[model samples]
Target: MTIRLASIEDHAALAGIFLSVRRSTFVWEDPASFQLDDFASATEGELIHVAETAENGIVGFISLWEPEQFVHHLFIANGHRGKGIGRALLDDLARRQPGPFRLKCVAGNSVALSFYKRSGWAQIGEGETDGRPYLLMELSKTDESTLSSPST
Candidate 1:
């Protein structure tokens, strides 16, 4: 797979992945509440990167609020998880932006929480959104150093 900045042509596919992944992963949320247009709104004014494969075209995406070095979204297409697509998108972003980045993960999503933790993000705080609790995570400048170093 290859990772690159998302083009306007990639939006439709990225939106589909966003909608589908959220619908499937956030089981507690009403799937019908997720709309294709939600992608445009959520990612507006942000920098987005997409993961593409020769066969799948676009399999995943990540969006960052560059002004704050905040990662707003990261989703892999269903059937494409566990393939390192998400990590590649993240590593690409880190290489390009060199972030002390922050993001929020829904507290109920254990899999995602674990992924972030294993990714060198630490829980710095917590907050609620739409009445649901979420963990506030950050990859600090200190933590970022380790992301690039060889794991012994």
Candidate 2:
């Protein structure tokens, strides 16, 4: 799979990927509530990177709002999970912003929670969004050295 910055031409594909992944993963949310136009508007003016395969087109994407130091969105297309695409996208983000990174995972989404935990993110707190509970996670730059140090 190739990971690269998204271009204007990629908007429609990216929006579709986001819709599919979000619908499948966040089943608790009303799927009908997620509109393609909303996804496009939400992703506008952000730093987005897409993962594409020659055979499958755009399979995943990660978006970051640099000004806010937040990961606005990260989604992998249906049937495209567990293949390291998420990690590759995140690795790209870390390379670009080697500072504190933060994101929220819906509390009941165990798959996402586990992935984030395994990816070196620590849960700092909890909150609710649209009435759904979420865990606030962060990967601090300082934590990197701590994570690499030999445990004594």
Candidate 3:
């Protein structure tokens, strides 16, 4: 798989992944609320990177709110989780922005929380969004080990 900046051509695939993942993963939310076009609205003005494979095409994407080094979203397609695609996308982002990056993971997403912990992100705080609780996570400036290399 290769990670690169998303193009206009990649938008449809990105939207699909975003919609499907949110619908499947966020059980606490009304799945019907996540629309394909939600991806474009949510990620507007952010820097986006996509993971693509020769066979599977676009499998995942990560978007960053650059000014604050905030990670706005990271979603992998339904069949593509736990395959290092998320980490690869993050590493690619670090290589590009060299961030002390931050993101908010829904409190109910234990799977995602585990992934973030394994990736050297820590729970720096807590907050609520859209009436749902979330854990504020951060990868500190010193936590660069996972950002070291690109995975295949």
Candidate 4:
């Protein structure tokens, strides 16, 4: 898979990938909440990266709000998970920023919680948003060693 900056032409495809992955993963939520227009509007001006395949076009994407040092979104298409695309996108971001990174995972989403923990992210806090419980996680640049270490 090839990872690169997302272009204007990639917006629609990225939106589709975002919607599909989110709908499947967050099955407990209403799918209508993941709207394409809202995604397009919210992601505007963010540092968005896309993971693509020569044959499949764009398969996954990661969007970061550099100013806030937060990851606003990271989604890999349903059929494309477990292929290292998520890690590749994250590693690319880590290399670019080399600083503290933060993201939130829904409380019941064990898959996401596990991935973040395994990637060296520590749960820093917990709270509820939109009536759903979530965990706030962070990974520091000084903790790079844990990035490559096995998940405890």
Candidate 5:
């Protein structure tokens, strides 16, 4: 397996994997929250990284925010969970994003919470917004080990 930069051609394949895993991984979220529709050519301060097999088939991805390097979204194929693909993606992003990175996890997403915790991301604070619970978490730019595994 390999992790590398993503391109427009990778969007469709990545989106397909996302859809297959969304129902279970993101059950706390709306099924359509961030479907990969307009991102086929997504650009400008956006970085989408993909984890693929040796033959170049997409399995998972993580989006790193430009300037801040905060991880925006990460997902792995439902069938590929527990295989460390998520960690590979996170490690790649951490190596590239050079700042105190941050991400939000819903209050009820125990799986995600555990993932973040095990990966070395610590909870800083939390509250609800738009009826959804949110916890503010950050990963120091130098601590690339924190995302070893997204708990769930």
Candidate 6:
């Protein structure tokens, strides 16, 4: 499997992967709100990326806004779940040595909630969109700097 940064030229393929995942995972959350045109908004130098397989390709993807490091989205093709792909993506991102990381999960999405929890993210807050509540989870890289209490 290969995971790499996505370029603007990858718009079509990336959009298709996202649309497919949306149908299954985001049926209620986003519906058709996320579109192909949105790929152009990715802009290079960001953390957006796609994951491909050795043979059956474009299996999954993930992205987050820079600095804020708020996870925008992550999805694996329907048939590709249960493998370590999702975990690999998370592990790879965590290994990148960022200051802090965050992602929001729909309150009803038990699968996603559990996945994030097992990966060491703790609930910090929540958000609501269109009357649906989303639980925000965060992972702060454990380092000497973070272990120390903030000074007043």
lDDT, candidates in the order shown: 0.85, 0.82, 0.88, 0.82, 0.73, 0.73
Residue ranges of candidate 3 with Cα displaced over 4 Å: 142-148
Question: Across residues 21-47, which tens digit of lDDT does each residue of candidate 5 receive?
Answer: 765566766776656653443333668
Q: For each candidate, what TM-score against the reference?
A: 0.92, 0.88, 0.93, 0.89, 0.80, 0.79
| Model 4 residue 37 CA deviation in Å | 1.8
Better of 1 and 6 by TM-score: 1
- State the lDDT at 132 in candidate 4: 93
- Model 6 lDDT per residue over 1-152, tens place: 77777776666777777677776787575566777666556433457777787687777777877778877777787788877777667666665547488888999999999988876789999999778999999988645443322211
Worst 10 residues of 2 by lDDT: 143-152
- Candidate 5 runs further than 4 Å off: 29-45, 141-152
Q: How does model 4 score by TM-score?
A: 0.89
Question: What TM-score does prediction 6 earn?
Answer: 0.79
lDDT of 4 by residue, 29-56 (tens): 8887888677788787789989888899
Find the 10 residues in a row with the least total lDDT in model 3. 142-151
Instruction: Give the Å error, residue 6, model 4.
Output: 0.7
* TM-score for predicted model 1 compared with the true structure: 0.92
Which pairs, if any, clash in model 5? 115-150, 115-151, 119-146
Query: How far off is residue 10 in model 5, in Å?
Result: 0.6
lDDT of 1 by residue, 45-120 (tens): 9999888888979988889999999999999999999877777777777777867899999999999999888777
Report clash pairs, candidate 3. Answer: none
Task: Give the count of colliding residue pairs in each prediction.
Answer: 0, 0, 0, 0, 3, 0
Q: Pairing residues by index, what is the TM-score of model 2?
A: 0.88
